[model samples]
Target: MEASELRRAVEAGRATASELGLDVDDVVVVHDSDRVALHLVPCGVLARVAPLGHLAASEFEVEVARRLADGDAPVAELDPRVESRVHVRDAFAVSLWTYYEPVGSEIASTDYADALLRHHAALRQVDLDAPHFTDRVALALREVNDREHSPELPEPDRRLLSDTLGGLGAAVGTDRADDQLLHGEPHPGNLLNTRRGPLFVDLATCCRGPVEFDLAHAPDDVAQHYRGADHGLLHRCRALNWAMFSAWRWRRVDHMPDRDHWRVEGLNRVRAALDRCGPGRPEAGGAGTPVG
Candidate 1:
């Protein structure tokens, strides 16, 4: 939506903003992604609003606000003096929050690794079913698993689909940690480089699931992309998720060329996981194969 339309919405109270007791000036739209991220400058408060598309989850934004309100220690945000809130702007899915001047980096130089561990640890607070990641996975599997689609799929993608379905079933079945929380889509882009050190943004996909599902993104890979540093964990999970998530993404946007790569990568992830778990696990179909 246009800034003028959004401004009118805010003015009409169709959307909510802080009652800061001040008159506002012009609204500046800051493009973070294709559809969202905007800046609104008033006399006193500067607002940063992000309107997410359907692909992004609203629960993540809600969780961020909740955590901030709860005073979750790790979440460094704008100055406390400048408060923020997450509100739905439209059916298109947008989060309206205030802008905060960066005080430091998103990741602490001395404590980056520890901060990641802690951040992953905190994801346990989200809802698994309400946000419904598992259902999404299941739907993706159903779409590709059908014989009509499988035969037409490239060899790499075919195997990737077969493997992802099998792997998810195995992970859930053996997951002794039944109720693990996850930052469904944690990545470096979601994190902000602020003055306070490694502040997290883009809580649009914060929900509960297997830690592996969240860790699947691999912080090291994101770090490498952003900082050009080596991180084994990040690399491993990046590859793993690349393998698996493609099936899900394909289910949503099947026409994309990247789907081919995702399928191949997924097969590799399956191979790695199977090597670790051994042949004891059953395949997605009735067929059996070597564990290693």
Candidate 2:
């Protein structure tokens, strides 16, 4: 929704604002895409709005945030004053959050790793029904296979992605023995350095998977600090991550100009990783083994 439209929606939903004890002065569009985040200043609340169909996932995130908050985990805290229930305004589902100022500095690998490990530990204690990591891979594969949605992807790359996803899915089932709760995508971009220290945002992607799957999205130094991570599994997970995200980017390439570059780079990485461990390759066994 545009800022003007969102403002009107917020105005129409004054009952929601009152329920949250928010005295909204103004609404600034902080981020706009599949989800829209509006900064409600003076009220100090961030309103995140997504499609109405996303209510379940949005509620899941709030629950996760609530659990993490109880344990003092390094994650963005949900506003307790407001019920975390999804507020429906027309076609959009809105949720309110406590706003914090971004530090705007690059976080160190050690700091990022520490926060991630702490959050992961806390997440392990919470039991919530979330999609498995493979579900996401399957979704990406479906998108790639959908000719109407992915007309931009070349036929050869689509075949490569299908084959790669199949191999990676089988490898994950056979290789990973330490599957657990994960932050899904704990890269530096998702870690916001606030006064409360590095807090994780965007809990929408939380899933159950190999810890290595989470590390696959982190920097090498961050992964190294996550002691006992199987490097070989991490490598395979990284390749799978690249393939999945690459497919997702490709699916949206027509809508996002900047994604074109990253999509190509990610596809190249996926191709290289697949070639190394694909059937008949010397490194085929490497996918299931621990790195020396």
Candidate 3:
């Protein structure tokens, strides 16, 4: 998350867009996280630029967008001006996406839920070569277990992440007969209340998991509206999500905004969720306790 790295990513986006015959002169940095999302002015294209190391993730997302669009799912479309694919330039990976003008700060919970439900229904038809949800947990688990990578992470918190990731991964990993392709994270951040309609973005997080696992990323109001979700499974997934987040916050290489604040908050959330865990799965009839 260095400025220089983002500069390179922006350069990559501009260079690739120029090659594609988009009169890209000025670019605006809309977001800076694992990737630098640049708004290519005049062309109205949102180029999500990241390091070359993220090529696999970007490529997978591009394919997801294309397939979802084919299925008529509510996803942010890839830039159709050029071929729908990831463009690499100057050792960076660039994917051009349709930049929707933000119509509001947020969308209604029901709208968000319905849009995600539509995506889930459409996702059932997609069979991309993506990893399972636990596969991602395994990645975070490695970060927690590697002391050299997270030397400052206290042993107790490390142990918490290790156990939660391992146990919940097993609990949710068993019996995938009903699992479907999920948006990885269908949270509000990924849900854009655009002038066109409700659309979801950031498809790289797509994974094979139960619907509750995807619902866990959403707000409680949203989860309440998502049809037929297993409350018990949602609880486990919420806790596991917090653990994975904690692992990332504690990673030495992660420098996301407000690291200290979120790290503490996420740890507290994990503890509260674990405290709510029962000897057996709670009767699956009621809404899960607010997890965030």
For this target, which candidate reaches the highest TM-score against the unseen true structure?
A: 3
For model 2, residues 117-155, the per-residue Cα lDDT tens digits are 888889888878777899888888888888888888777
Q: Which lDDT value does model 2 have at 59? A: 82
TM-score of candidate 1 on Cα atoms, chains taken together:
0.59
Assess candidate 2 and give its lDDT: 0.75
lDDT of 1 by residue, 1-292 (tens): 4656565444422233444443455555454332445444563233344344442454445446566445353554432443344445444343445355555534543454445556665655533344544555565577667655455555445555556555654455344444455556655555556555565665556555555555555443334333323233233334445544655544543544466665555555655654444444324332222333
User: Which should have the higher TM-score, number 1 or number 3?
Assistant: 3
Candidate 2 minimal-lDDT segment of 10 residues: 281-290
Q: Rank the candidates by TM-score, best first.
A: 3, 2, 1
Question: How high is the lDDT of residue 60 in model 2?
Answer: 81
The prediction achieving the highest lDDT against the true structure is 3
**TM-score for predicted model 3 compared with the true structure:** 0.93
RMSD (Å) per prediction: 7.4, 5.1, 4.3
**Candidate 3 lDDT tens digits, 78-130:** 98889999988998889998888899666888888898889999999987877
In candidate 2, the residue pairs with backbone N, CA or C atoms under 3 Å apart (3 or more residues apart, or in different chains) clash, namely none
Report residue 177 deviation for candidate 3 (angstroms): 1.4
